[model samples]
Target: MGYLYIFGTILFTVYGQLILKWRIEKYGSLPPLVKDKILFLLQLLVDPLILSGFLSAFVASIFWMGAMTKFDISYAYPFMSLSFVLVFILSVFLFQEPVTLYKVIGLSFIVVGIMITSQSV
Candidate 1:
């Protein structure tokens, strides 16, 4: 059950990121960093998809808090990296993004590191 919470945290985090990326891309480029940044952020606030992504991030935090109650941060924090691996795979499938060899190698390392760290618990 504790592990499940960790997985929920990862999934929600990844989903939030992916949705934000997709919606932002659909909306086109943001204003320059030095100009009207507050207005740019305000635009995102009114976007339904971006708003949902923010909600997902909130849920992910809740799941993260629940996981922390059950496991040490060392054990749980490594699992958060799984969201990177998940988002990479999902982007390739959903957005027809390229999957490079380096990405594959890096993702494998992340998985291996998580596995090795989990053994300490």
Candidate 2:
């Protein structure tokens, strides 16, 4: 059950991150230092794609938090790092983004990290 939670968290978290990336591509970044409510509202309303992405991401976050509560951070957090690999794969097909050798190497590292962390737990 703990493992299930961990996997679920990783899945949702990756999906959420991909959604966020899509949102960013659709709408410009919102700087933390900025305090303009009017501009924020305009951005929110003007970009439907960004809005959908935001909504999906918000839903995924709830699942992620629940998973965190059910598992150890040291074990679960490392597993979540696999999301980097997942997101890379997702972006390649979903968004037609380029995948390079460096990304493949990074994904290999993530897999190795997951294996090591699982053994530790």
Candidate 3:
């Protein structure tokens, strides 16, 4: 059940990020940071999709806090790295992004590291 909370954290985090990216892509590029940055940020806040993304992130934090009560941070934090693996695979499919050899190798290392860390617990 603790693991479930961790996975929920990962899932919502990924969903929030992807939704933000999708909304940004669809809405056009952001104004330059130096050019009316505050207004640009305000505009982003009112966007429904971006608001949903923020909500997802908020929910992820809630799940993460719940997970923290169930296990040591050392035991749980490494599992968060699984989000990178998931996001990478998902980005390729959802965004038509290219998958490269190095990406595969790097993701494999993440999996290996998680396995090694799990052994200590």
lDDT preference between candidates 1 and 2, better one: 1
Candidate 3 on 50-103: residue-level lDDT in tens?
A: 999999999999999999999899989999999899889888999988999999
lDDT of 2: 0.73
Write down the TM-score of every candidate: 0.90, 0.69, 0.91
Clashes of each: 0, 0, 0
Candidate 2 lowest-lDDT run of ten:
48-57
Q: How high is the lDDT of residue 66 in model 2?
A: 72
Candidate 2: where are CA atoms >4 Å away?
23-41, 45-49
List ranges where model 3 is wrong by over 4 Å: none
lDDT of 1 by residue, 1-121 (tens): 9988998899889999999989888867777875677787788889998999999999999999999999999879998999989999999998899999999999999999989998954
Model 1 residue runs over 4 Å out of place are 32-38
